[model samples]
Target: MKILNIYRSEPDATTKKLVEIVTRDRESVEFDLNVDAPDYDKLVDEIFAADKTICWW
Candidate 1:
């Protein structure tokens, strides 16, 4: 299954480990919103394409 991980902020160690465990042995894509200008357009596309989406704050 395809999993899309969206980070609202920089991930902490625990969050990182959990995401690793959840995405293990699966196709995953990561998008970070903590940048100068996040691409909402691409994020929308990814959300539509992914089978599951996880947003991390």
Candidate 2:
């Protein structure tokens, strides 16, 4: 399964561990929105492309 992990901020230790556990042995991609500029267009494409998405705050 393809999973997309979207982070609204830098991930905490718990969040990072959870993401690691959930995405184990699966295809995963991560996108960070904490940058100066985030590409909504690419984010949209990634969302559509993945089977599941997890937003980390």
Which residues of candidate 1, in runs, are more than 4 Å off?
A: none
TM-score of structure candidate 2: 0.96
**Per-residue accuracy of model 1 over 1-57 as CA lDDT, tens digit each:** 999999999999999999999999999999999999999999999999999999998
Candidate lDDT scores, in order, read 0.97, 0.97
Among residues 3 or more apart in sequence or in different chains, the pairs in candidate 1 whose N, CA or C atoms overlap within 3 Å are: none
Question: In the order shown, what is each candidate's alpha-carbon RMSD?
Answer: 0.6, 0.6
lDDT of 2 by residue, 1-57 (tens): 999999999999999999999999999999999999899999999999999999999
Q: Please give the lDDT score for candidate 2.
A: 0.97
Compute the lDDT for candidate 1: 0.97
Clashes of 2: 0
Residue range with the least summed lDDT across 10 consecutive positions in model 1: 6-15
